[model samples]
Target: MKLLLITAIEEFEKDVINILKNSRLKAFSYQSVKGFKNDKNEMKNWFGKDDIAVDSLLFTVFSEYNCVDSIYKNINEFNSMQQTVPHIHIVTINLEDENFR
Candidate 1:
């Protein structure tokens, strides 16, 4: 088993969900989050603020290795076709053991 963590701006929520479904990932969890960036570009700042906050989502999936690989490949394809920033980000961690009681 492995733990998959996927993050992207809230605007891409539907796209993310579609990717997960297409990958045949049966179960997962997600939550809304605030993404922070300390950009020096004044024009990019909101209301002259130095920091920017973006509405984002974090997806957590526990799955087998093969499923993780499929999800990664699908996300890469989705990002490559985009013509903008804030692309989806995904990572995985190996699960050495688990306990359920």
Candidate 2:
């Protein structure tokens, strides 16, 4: 198994979720988060307001490595077809083992 993590703009969460679901990749977890780029000072537009401080949607999914391609494709499509926005991090790692509640 493998783990996939994606951090993207908040407004895109719903679209991301839909894309994931449509891709037949279910059984995942997600949350909304507030964060900023390392060069926030350079991106003055993101400063001075709580609402515009930079918020993103984070999603975590555990699946076969092949699933990564589909997810990445979906995300890329979403970004290109929609308005360009915040930074995103896509982390994929092997899952040695697991326990769940």
Candidate 3:
């Protein structure tokens, strides 16, 4: 199995979900989280109209490697279409049975 993790601004959560829905994966889990961004990032400090700028961390497991590949492609397409959006990070991890059991 493999784990697909997508981390991005809260505003992009729906876009990520839409991309996931179009993929072969069956389900996923996501939640809000607090994190700091570099001074050069769009979020900057936590004292403006955007507040703390919580991130939406979405993740799921793919039983097949192709699923991960497809999702990464979809995510890249999504990223390319946006110019003003903050940088999002996508990671795919291979999981071993021993790590869980």
Choose the strongest candidate by lDDT.
1
Clashing pairs in 1: none
Error of 1 at 60 (Å): 0.3
Q: Highest TM-score: give the candidate number.
A: 1
Best of the two (2, 3) by lDDT: 2
Clash statistics: count for each candidate: 0, 0, 0
> How far out, in Å, is residue 36 in model 3?
0.9
Please report the TM-score between candidate 3 and the true structure: 0.72
Residue lDDT tens for model 2, 1-101: 88888776776677778877876775889988776545645644332234444667779888766678888887777656654445345678888887742
- The C-alpha lDDT values of all candidates are 0.81, 0.69, 0.66
Candidate 2 residue 38 C-alpha distance from true site, Å: 2.9
Worst 10 residues of 1 by lDDT: 42-51
Model 2 score (lDDT) = 0.69
* Tens-digit lDDT string for candidate 3 (2-99): 77777777777788878778886777888777655545456443212353445555455454566777778888887787775464567777777635
Q: Which stretches of candidate 2 lie over 4 Å from their true place?
A: 40-52, 87-89, 99-101
Global lDDT of model 1: 0.81
Total backbone collisions, model 1: 0
